[model samples]
Target: MGVGSSSQNSSAMVAIKSQEDQGSAPDLKPKKKICCACPETKKLRDECIVEHGESACEKWIEAHRKCLRAEGFNV
Candidate 1:
C-alpha cells in the first residue's frame, strides 16, 4: 500500500511538472513597448523617425521618452 501511494504521488508530480513546462509565461516582456497612455506623443515620435530618421529625430524622441518615463515605462 505504501509503495502504491508513493507511485501515485510521483506520477502526480510528473504531471504537474509537465503542465508547468508547457505553460507560456504571461509576464514576458514585449518585443517593443509603445507608449500606452500617450498615443499622440508616440505617433509624433514615430512620424519623426520615419520622416527624418533616428539621428535627426532627437527632440521628438526625447519628448516621447519623457512622456513614457512620466507614465512609469522604461523607454
Candidate 2:
C-alpha cells in the first residue's frame, strides 16, 4: 500500500509539473460578466430604451456605452 501510494503521489507531482511547464495551472480568478458588470447604466438603458423610445434615449445610450467601456467592454 505504501509503495502504491508513493507512485500515485509521484504521478500527481508529474501532472502538476507538466501543467506548470505548459502554463496550464487552474485559474480561479473572476472574469467580467456583462450582465452583472454595470448595473446603474444597464438599468438606465432598460428604462430609457425598453420603456421609452430609442431616439429619446440617446443620452442614456451614450451613458451606457461609457459605462460598458469603463467596465472593459469594447463598446
Candidate 3:
C-alpha cells in the first residue's frame, strides 16, 4: 500500500511539472463572472468618459482594461 501511494504521488508530481513546463497549467480562468471586478478603475473610467467624453478618457479606459486583465478577465 505504501509503495502504491508513493507511485501515485510521483505520477501526480510529474503531471504538474509537465504542465508547468508547457505553460499550459490551468492558471487564468476562462472568464471572470463578477461584474464588480476592478471597481476602482471601472469607476474612474466611467466617470471620466461621462464627464469628459470617451476620447478624453482613453487613459482611464486603458487603465481599466489593464486592471481587468490582471483580474483574469478577457476584457
> All models: lDDT?
0.77, 0.80, 0.85
All models, RMSD in angstroms: 9.1, 8.4, 8.0
The candidate scoring highest on TM-score is 3
Residue range 20-71, candidate 1, lDDT tens digits: 9868634434344553567888888889899989999888888887876666
Model 3: CA > 4 A from native = 1-26, 30-34
Root-mean-square deviation of candidate 1: 9.1
Output the worst ten-in-a-row residue range by lDDT, candidate 2: 22-31
lDDT of candidate 3 at residue 17, scale 0 to 100 = 91
Sort order, lDDT high to low: 3, 2, 1
Clashing pairs in 2: none
Give residue 28's error in model 3 in angstroms: 1.0
Residue-wise C-alpha lDDT for candidate 3, range 1-75, written one tens digit per residue = 687999999999999998889796458873555477888998999899999999999999999889888877777
Better of 1 and 2 by lDDT: 2
Sort the candidates on TM-score, descending order.
Answer: 3, 2, 1
**Model 3 backbone overlap count:** 0
TM-score of 1: 0.50
Give the Å shift of residue 12 in candidate 2. 39
lDDT of candidate 2 over 1-75, digit per residue (tens)? 777999999999999998888686444333687788678988888898877789889998899888777766766
lDDT at 6, model 2: 93
Error of 2 at 41 (Å): 0.9
